[model samples]
Target: MYISILCFGIFSCQDLNLEPKGMLGGPELFGNEYGVKKYFAAIYNALPIEDFLYYGTNSNNAYRPDNYWEAGKNSLGNMSGEFFNTWVQVDNDGFAYWPYDRIRDINVFIQSFPEYQVNYTAEVYNNLLGEAHFLRAFFYFGLAKRYGGVPIIKEAQDPLAPVETLEVPRNSEYDTWKFIYEDLTFAMENMSTDIDETGRANKYVAAALLSRTMLYAGSIAKYSQYLGFQGEAATSAGMAGIDASKADEFFQYCVDAGKVVETGPYALYTRGYPDKAKNFADLFLDAESSESIFIKSYDITAPGNNRLRHSYDALMCPQPDMSSFVGAESYPPLDFMELYDMPAIVNPDGTPVRFDHRGDIRNGMEPRARGTMYFDGDVLRGKAFDIQRGIYKNFDVLASDADQGSPNAPINNPNNRILGGRGWTTEINGTTLNITGAHGNFEDQGGENNGWGSAFIRKYVDPDRATSDVREYRSDQHWVVFRLGEIYLNTAEALYELGSRDEAFNYIEKIRERAGATITRPALDQSTSNIGTINKANYPYSIEKSLQFIRDERARELYGENHWWWDLRRWRTADQVLNQFRHRVLSSYYVADEGKYIYLDEINRINRSWTASKQCYYEPIPWGEIGKNRNLLPQNPLY
Candidate 1:
């Protein structure tokens, strides 16, 4: 009675006649509602949702794949330069993520689910079918973003069929997006609005997916030509880039999807009330927050399932203090910190701004920045973060005198600038004072467990987990897949792109107000520039200054949420943005003579830089898959 399942891996040409060992029969597994849920569980587990457990490496572990303790160190943030780390660099050539096996499963479900209609109510039957479509759209989205025009295999192919019939040609980039749009549209229409299952897709969740995917498609249609790949075979074949004429069509789809989500029972989370920083931080931790549209739940109790638990807390916080395992592998670079409304580190006179306490740097900063990163005095697990770079014995010169912590700077000489490893001290006037703080900037230490930058990522780190329990694979914080805040940003960006500038700012203003930004709304500036101010990236296309501001707001709000890398790719600016992009650090120095603290901008001690080639925009359709099906040629541009 057991059904034989043919396991496939991205169009593998190998034909092996093997026996099915442990198979679940369709009659027993897909005949009823509970059985259908059970059947869908395996498909859900293989989703390409990049969450905390995602490992950004040149392996198969890119999509929600688990490497346990190393996941945090190999996170997309580290690879994307969103969070500075010594371990990982820009994985320019992606990890060849092909999820045809999962796609096949969804296809099977879609084709076979109708047979079970006799066992359920009409609503339940339609809902399950709609859910299947939603899952397929998600898989397609993962593929379309990475490979452009992938082969759209809607029906489950019979392995026993003729080879010619089984081999499907690749679809055009526009058609691929249109297919996803259609699938999501059907899902939104047929899926019930009342289903409350956690982590399961409902009608609103389908709309969120539509909103995200269409936004991506719109961006590609509008910006892909800027990459100048028109002469390439893939571009000419309409496989790698979408036509600019189709931009408005996809943008309008995104706008419509956003409107659909707005009709759902979702709102921006604001439970923490007056303390906007705490409110922003709590939004991620609160599983029941109204802002969360769709979440991928994790459970620490699921011991055997590595994807169910993550090591975020252990690898993000300093060891023996904030974590019980290897401490703090990643730190927030000062380049990103300055994006928020920050207190000036240097005065008009060009000297470092002296502060009464080291924590004064947080005084005028945006609440969202504080919420996203842990500062010097920020407390976690009842212990305050003690982060100081070093002390200046007699610093009485312009901040530039240090020359971005240059070794040849006269003021930076070892005799004057005191720096040390963890717990190292100096004797000044018979009083021994610790040179560096307990948490970081250990001059003699490597970047592995030492804090390289000024702050630690605080967005998804579980504050409630005790230090004793913060070991490898012991943390369980749900990854917010689709949230109302992100939806708002998506809507705003699409609105702006569609020429509805005033309506776009309405959403931006709401997000900034919640983040406690000093300027809730800034006047629009239509001045166009090809070079961005943030990274000074020389983009191929000119963009409005106001548009860049909107993009920056997305970064500020969604920091460490695995969106920056994708954002850069879709904007066709990855290569320019990451061109020898060296991260900067904010070093806290205590002036010995003045007895005050000063924060100075300095290059990361290791001087590590991130670089992405044009090839990064679209990962080459995995060579193996191309070998199996020649139709996947002429591989992605600049492969």
Candidate 2:
């Protein structure tokens, strides 16, 4: 059965006979290689690739929607406790992302492309068919990750068909992932090894997809039972969790797929030599980076296409100095900053360590942390970042005396602490001093356009754009979807889970070597525990200490790349990890008597906390879909 394709006419024609040039019919679209390329472009645009322009409001704005300049404010980083921001919190219920329309478009191509096989050679025909299979698998992956078991719709159904015939039931969770595996396997077997045009999938790209998706599947298989939903309807029916016995099979699949990707012509990016920090920072801005497995390009040249440009720079850097627009919206939290090897901000005696200059905090910090964030005195666009919080008069007590910057602390008296808004000044002993830094910690102002923490997000931010040109919708930096750095991390985790501990750290060392970490290769510890050191989350099931290290490494390497939320969900630890999690900020202060600077840990001004419920592991299927097709009933586990 086939659904009729509609083509609307713009002009009314009574007697005039004319051949329409505006739209192409089925044969004209699928008959030639060029025509098929044009057809595939639309499908590529509708993919579930979450890039810089993704707005997390609802399904309509999920897939790179146009004019979504507010993404930086409400980014996945802010919502998942990766960064501190005032705009969005953890939304337990997802935006109901069902993309059957896009799936139907691909299904039409798969069903109809064979009719034009005579127009092309056998190799070209087979490659195109394999590309279609890869596309279908991508849509299924998006569904399986959100709702555990969605209906498997391979063929396009007719709209006029009987209701009973069209209402397909949901497949089991294991079967849904198996279907994705089959499609990706077909893609790997038939797709060409040669690179396709930029932004298109090749055999290597398909393998990268397989590597990531199967890792998620392997995680679900191993950790779903720990969520304690064993007797629920979805769990009992095998719709929400996979059997624990299948964990090794899925992990092996992930490891094998990663090995295939390594065979391709790709390597970790190392363009800016000698300065490992600069090299790491340049990876995201370099368009021809060798580390990039697949990337989605954005352009500012197109006049009216809002999706072609983003506002990352404008929302990340401060106003009047770095950006001409709204200014910084998200700042790095101290919790994440401590994940890296930072300098000693406090002495062994529990007193705050005073630095000759505030920028001296970067002296012994990890180079990767330096590359990921901008500290005081880090210059960009001809202006140095001055991120001091306030000034402390006379000798200071232990850091605990400040009580995390609480207002009720005795040391926080107005006479002892000098806090002010942006550009504010105060007179002291015949001289005037600026209260807050030029960029942040404005006590009188809110979080909007103010740097709430001591550091700013530098990942994926364009450094070369002139301040005058840094307006909303004027910056165009490509968002990398799959890079070699991430592939290495995926392989390392999968290998460790399969009990190959030594081989896992081999991959971890390579990543740390590029970032110039202090301990490039630490001795492996196989001791098992369920207590997470980062958030102190108590997991229901125990894992090896080396495995937890691999997980933390993923957070450090993939910071601000929009992977934290999904990582927490896939591990079945979101509820425990984010239980009333309050992001902390590092505040810098100038000592009036000692003429030095001190950095102390403090809670954010607003005291915002993010919490995720147990049900956040799996989103409920869209209620509207169940209304139309009752077969979609057993709506996810909790909702």
Candidate 3:
């Protein structure tokens, strides 16, 4: 250790003695600009941004299985219904944050800022102060979303205070939201719009968060009655419900926030893009995209943190061709797959298209579905990923066994499916061909992959880079936090909720247009091609139908992007949508005799089911925290 000569008071040693506090150098060190910057670094390190580094309570570790889910690969996709994990799990709605020390830093920053020795301009002071407020509000909003209401600690609590004195009671849910609102309003007011720092929170970022969080609060308030809000504290202290009159107020907050953000340089991500699919696919990869409102930049230059960008690719990319680092832990479920518009049998009129041919069902679907998911025949890097369940061998017994819900090993056998580097060779008509579309092999450890029939998960894969030589573990693309497309959807949803139905529909149409979706079926690449277009019908004007459309639209628009889990919860439809779902069949087979493909074999596909209850909607507060603070008594209902 080196010692530095310091004159606490140059005028006199008496001046140093005049200081009432015991420490002289300590205060001066932190009161300077560089000292503040060092403190800020520590604060930044603890912010609950929850982008890539976030890990849920018990998710599987992708790169390091001996460790917990640090990289959190495919966690968002698996938790939401958009994709399935290779290993089946009873999912938990996680709120993996309890950052009190960070908040303490924010409190100190807010209070002790004026005492700093350095001469900071008013703008610098405001920006620093405003950022603190924004972080505090963002952090608190996350708490409110998970716990309904949490203790509001505005001022720094006295460290020396007795435990009894520190045990503050929990605030009501409405109060918690209002607390967040107050902090955010302050932040938006004081923060500068001039700064263009990537990954740094600014006035626009605060507004965007306010827009989203306020919408959540307003909706929870308005729909609590509809969504089953009946709890002891709900009526007592507004813990779980807000007054119905406040719905419009909060909705206006979201609307106003959106308006503020929309006026900026932000816009949708679909201009100069020749096709809709490419336009949609490239949205997340493009770092300079005006669509991104708040971004967490990940470049090859980010020191020692290559894990941030690479975790997602390692978890979501297809297993067959992808590097060994990948887990292949995500694939769209059959029900989720069916939500896309079919390519075949165009809904020329505004009506639902019925499934007449099972084999050809996946074709002719919505263009957005193509942009969102990887289906059975999705090609990547010039590989077709030929995903057929079984070849037509004229042997009915094994096929029947597949229907009878037999163990997957037999179906994975060479006699049944192509196995052990072998293709099923058979003579058909006058020619001999080896049909090699079968792809599956479950992992015994069930860590890396669980051959769930190659539907190959494909949402955030980079199109610009050739995935052929890609696994450096640096996913290297920015994860979008907010975007103008989402804002448009939020505006539509808010307008509808606030009784502006026509306006709502118009906003929805903007998104549909950007997506290349239309009132009727979308046109195909070629007339003869059976591949799908946006197969669904046009919006009907009824509010009920419009609401349903919104539900489907959200699922389609935000699939695998980590938004569905919250959507289902906020809509109060978690119990209904997530309660019991069936994976009845693994992969569908084709029937050539009828000159049609039979995709579903309902007779043999015994139910493979999943269930989540209302309780799964809210996360449980840590038992340790509750035990430590008796004031947090009567733990969140149903805990």
Model 3, span 19-95: residue lDDT tens: 54543343553466565555555455455554555443353232223332234443544544446553443355554
Per-prediction TM-score to the true structure, in the order listed: 0.96, 0.96, 0.80
The lDDT per prediction is 0.87, 0.85, 0.60
State the lDDT at 114 in candidate 1.
Answer: 76
Q: What lDDT score is found at residue 10 in candidate 3?
A: 16
lDDT of 2 by residue, 247-323 (tens): 88888988999999999999998888779888899999998999988889888997856478888999999998999
| lDDT pick, better of 1 and 2 | 1
Off by over 4 Å in 1: 1-23, 64-66
Q: How many collisions per candidate?
A: 0, 0, 20
| Per-residue lDDT over 1-639 for candidate 1, one digit per residue giving the tens place of the 0 to 100 score | 011142242123123333344444455566888878877787887788878878876767676555557888888889999989898999878888888878877787787677777988989899999999999999999999988998999888898998877767889999999999999999999999984799999999999999999999999999998888999999999999999999999999999999999999998888998999999999999988999998999898886655788888888889888899888899898878999988899999999998998888999898999899999899999999988888889888999999998878999999989999999999877878789889869978787678786788899888989999988888888999999888999999999999999899999998998899965455788889898755678988999988998999999999999999999999999999899999889999888888899998999988899999998988888888877888778888887
- Could you tell me the TM-score of candidate 1? 0.96
On lDDT, the stronger of 2 and 3 is 2
Give me the displacement of residue 207 in model 2, in angstroms.
0.7
| C-alpha-based local distance difference test score of model 3 | 0.60
